[model samples]
Target: MFARRRPCRRPSPDLRCRPSGRATFAAFAVAVTLLPSLAQAQCGGSFSGFVRGLKDEALAAGYGAATVNSFFNGAAQDPKVLKADRAQGVFQKPFVEFSRRLISNDRIQRGARKSQELNKVFHRIETTYGIDRGVLLAFWAFETDYGAFQGDFNTRNALLTLAHDCRRPDLFRPQVFSALELYARGGFDPARTTGAWAGEIGMVQMLPGDILENGVDADGDGKVSLKTSAPDALMSAAKMLSHLGWQPNQPWLQEVTIPADLDLEETGLLHRKSVADWQADGVRAKSGSFALRKGPAALILPQGHKGPAFIAYPNFDVYFEWNQSFTYVLTAAYFATRLEGASVYDAGRPDAGLSGGEMKQLQKKLQARGHDVGKVDGILGAKTRLAVQKEQARLGLPADAWPTPALLKRL
Candidate 1:
């Protein structure tokens, strides 16, 4: 198994790693006349041709030939990066299993110690950016084990390989230009700089585009160094979250208890209700008080009704802008709470869910039934969960968005 990484909204940087492998490179004609936007459609033709086109695109954007040439000098396509991209089966694990595995005692203690050690820097982050230190620390722990293992993939080749791949070229093409921008500013080393398989850099595993846009010089060294400087990484992470619309001091995810008779159909991200409305529906805090946040919240039953429950506030929605996986986001948010002194979540014994093969079969059923469940990759992604919920509602079961063995059998 490989270490997990985060995926971000749009083309922003995130973190991940997977096993490296080699694939046969394809060849295509060299036509270096199209603009970057138009050239994205032509990624699958050839690797060398794509790099040449990317170099031409850079030269046209006002970069000196020497700098652009230097950036692409040793860069070559890495098929291992592509293998990693298609191998995200780690996200298929349920939240309880996933979170328990990730939020270890060692990590929690380290996060607490880091909080105390970097109190001044975190204090500045909170005061200036209104982002909780625990939130950033939780991500830091997950992305690279607090920078302990931020993947050793070649940054330039990783970006170019993904940009040349046909699956998500649009998402990665802009990052190629952004990495060059960082190189131009003397921050990135095309040959030496390394990061996650997806090309995220530093402690938080931010992408090149995000680094160019949100990187901060918090240590006042006049450079935004996310890889080596904790202060810079933490501050830059806070800035990025704030830019993603994190509400100031508002609650993100809170553990809560719900009455057994509460309508399960009203759960999931699509059905958000006010805190007062939920309180009226007998949803009480598992600990603390409901007075902490007064805004709207979504009752996320991540592993169905028989598992851990959380009331996700508006700021919680912002987490998706940073990472797309529901399980990963919930784990990160819960870890942050642990760092902030919350108790271990009570993992209610959820009903047995579908296995990987069973899940892919269910996705096939969902697809055949006309619901757009994206890829049938065995991962219960957002679209698949929504399809599960719809089928559950139709089958007169609890539409809590958790697919069970029985649900699969029914389909």
Candidate 2:
């Protein structure tokens, strides 16, 4: 999730979540005017045509005419959703800055208070799903500040707009149908339900498909009220993470100290080695015990060799399934550790990172050199990092993937 302005926190991702925080209605209305032309172009002509097809599909899928009609009744193209989709480049911030911005003393204290207030709920989630409260709490804090603002976008419009958009129709289109199914089940309201711009519902910002699959009525309310029920939100998140293959009672991330001469090639998400092997290579835990010392782990130099390093375990991989942004995942995972009483990371003196403009230039250079860094969006994404590592190695620099001003100047 990316940062937001005022009252709200941030918007969460969809199945592989993207950021969609709150925006002002004045801004939302302005964005709407800029949408219709692009909407027509992208949705294959007038939005009505797309709605007609959706209605037909719903009817064919066996929903009654009234239900289908009502679901699509007032659905309109929301340009802001598309805007949020494209604006997710904010996740480009390096781990240290991003984490520092998000992990405030207020959030950490609030997370602790929430944990205590919901002790029974947390205990139930842990016992039932084998997931720790910190994971849920961290997400809860990030995705709407523990339910303070679960987005103000109209859920129906947000889903339809994304479904009609060209960029990721496949992901959002199916979610529309899933919302239909939830609506049919007496759970969703076409006009009333609202959350993240990406159509994620509730405090934890789950996609419609996830809600359909993992929703839990933890408070014995007979209905999974994620918006109003803390127990429901936390438990549903735990169940979803469990479904996402979260290893129970396992550590996801741990800050570590690496010897100066450590083989930089062995450090990265792709290169997994046993913890013992890493220890032999002089990667020692910064604090606390390793829950699974023999587990397979990757040495992640998030800001290259000079910045904070972490040993990411298998559970860390599961964060990608929740949100694909490497920086967001690392920050969230690290925050989870912080909520569980881990010490703050020791941020080493990493070289100054590239400006957004410089980063896009670097990405362009990497692409010209035949390395695929996805979009030249100024974000130091995974593919870009890999390309950076290759270039650094070729240039006789440390193969740590962190991009810096010096590297940019050299290139």
Candidate 3:
């Protein structure tokens, strides 16, 4: 009776519609509806916690907390960063042919104009870095399409993602930490930190560790910004070249005619030989000039037996240190030549680009016959070609060592 009287006397709008238990149940339903968002937030928070642990390690490495927080506070890991770390494809054409696609007429013209415009700074850089202006300009053109497409992905996020992904952890993890240190020092703003999917930043696409070590204030404004300042980026790249042992006054690579009927197997790993020695073997410069008299050079046949070859020098190896891909380094050298008004390559090579599946099958067949084809990775390198040659010799084929669908069928 007391309960009924109380309810009748004190029923308010807030309590009239539902009992306390019902109200509590409705609130629980709303919370259930928002559970997915809450879980997502929790996951993000866990990632942030990992970042904080990294930040503490960075501070122990002598970075300021403020700097660490600025870089990592809102940094989300990007999954696509691993795409850049995978090994690249094998091209059917030699580097000379590859370069023709990179150093187009339009690119050459723009490079020439840019070179002329930046002549003063170029001269200064050349004097200071002992690197040729044309070489640097060529790199600028090749790396970012003359700064037209330097990528728009967040650099920190990409680095962090790659570092966490164990495929290349040892290489990328330190880089991620180093980038954090750089950001902590006010070296660059987080918002301004953007680059390729693999964390290569700016016009030159240099990694963060490179920025920390080789970055220079070429503009004399007391900061290194690869994003906007051409001089800084170019100078930094030139400095990196110098560090990588770019010899002065040495030709990077030169086109050479391979002697007919020479045993390709006898060439054996492309050892460095004197120009005189190469001349004795019937390898001659395309221009009929033996200008590279000083250093040793190696013969590189990018497309096996039926493509243009080059006598690449020590400096050519240095280009490989910048980017490991033979195609990339060759393109860089070719672009440099175009910027200097040199003729494009005329490698009379044939197209033989195998699809990924085809290459895998070819590798498998070679392995089945017991040749060290090295992991069936769908890339045709020296090892793969050697395996093919061994298989061809076994089958009493022509032994040219080139892979084809016909060869696959026989296998």
Candidate 4:
């Protein structure tokens, strides 16, 4: 099962997701101008072709001759990273289980303890940025297990492999160039630069592009080091949140009880209205009276209508920006609530999600049936949800957009 948490708030335009290929467009122009000459330099054929292309891309994107050589390290697409990319375990879990795993009692206790230790520092950051301390701590714990594990993949190699892969080069290629920039000006050493499988480095697992673009020297150390510096990571995260549109006085999500008779189909972020409007439609606070008067909101069905429902605020989109999975963002938001002395979420059902392999099979069936579900990577996304809803409506099943074995079997 999956659980929903949160990463609320917004970032500036540049602080938002990296621009599509434009981060290095200038360099790309440079490379294009020198393409004929650059390729004439005799890169070994076959396996070296991709690496050579990447090298040219870096140089074109405006990195110096020395920069490209030092950055790439003769990187080629690594099978392990590719394998890891194709199979993400978190996206396959049901919401309740996913939430429990991320924000268990032990983790909650640890978060509280962390709060006491860093209370002063977080308060200061909060005063300056208006981001929640609990949310920042939750990001730290989930991203690196309170700095226990910050991944071990070679960032350049991982980005290199992903960039070479056909699945999402448009996404990873920009990241590859971004990492080179970090090497150039952000003071990251390729020899020691390692992070998440997707090349997200630092304690909070920020991508190199994001780090280079929005990194802040929180501790006033003149250099921003997210890996070794908690202040830097937290402050940088705040900048990203602000950039993405995080409202200072607003709650990202709220536990609300949706009426059974009210149109359950009209209960998702897409079918959004203000919390006031939702309340007028009979949505009541699950724990107490709703108090998110500072921002507009939407209802999120993390586990469909059978599970708990919440009114999502404008900042909910930021969580979606942080991690595309509804369950993950819900867990993040819920975890932040826990740090602020809230109870564990009372989920409404034992709904479970399909396994990664099973989801892939469902994706295949949906694709075969002529539904546009993007790639069959076993990750549940909007297109898959739309297709599933369409199929469910056709099959006389409730269009909850939650995947299950029964639906999979029928499809």
**Highest lDDT against the true fold, candidate:** 1
Q: What lDDT is reached at residue 326 by model 1?
A: 84
- Put down candidate 2 lDDT per residue, 349-372, tens digits, no spaces: 998888789999999999989999
Candidate 1 local distance difference test against the native: 0.82
What are the per-residue Cα lDDT tens digits for candidate 4 across 240-279? 7776677785677778787766665566666666677788
Best by TM-score: 1
Q: Model 3, which residues run further than 4 Å from truth? A: 1-53, 83-97, 266-270, 349-353, 365-376, 381-411
The backbone clash count of each candidate, in order, is: 4, 5, 1, 35
Error (Å) of candidate 4 at residue 206 is 0.8
Single out the weakest 10-residue window by summed lDDT for candidate 4.
Answer: 1-10
Task: Report the backbone clash tally of model 2.
Answer: 5
lDDT of each: 0.82, 0.80, 0.65, 0.72
The weakest ten consecutive residues by lDDT in model 3 span 1-10
| Stretches of model 4 off by over 4 angstroms after superposition | 1-47, 74-76, 294-296, 350-358, 368-370, 393-396, 404-411
Rank order by TM-score, top first? 1, 2, 4, 3
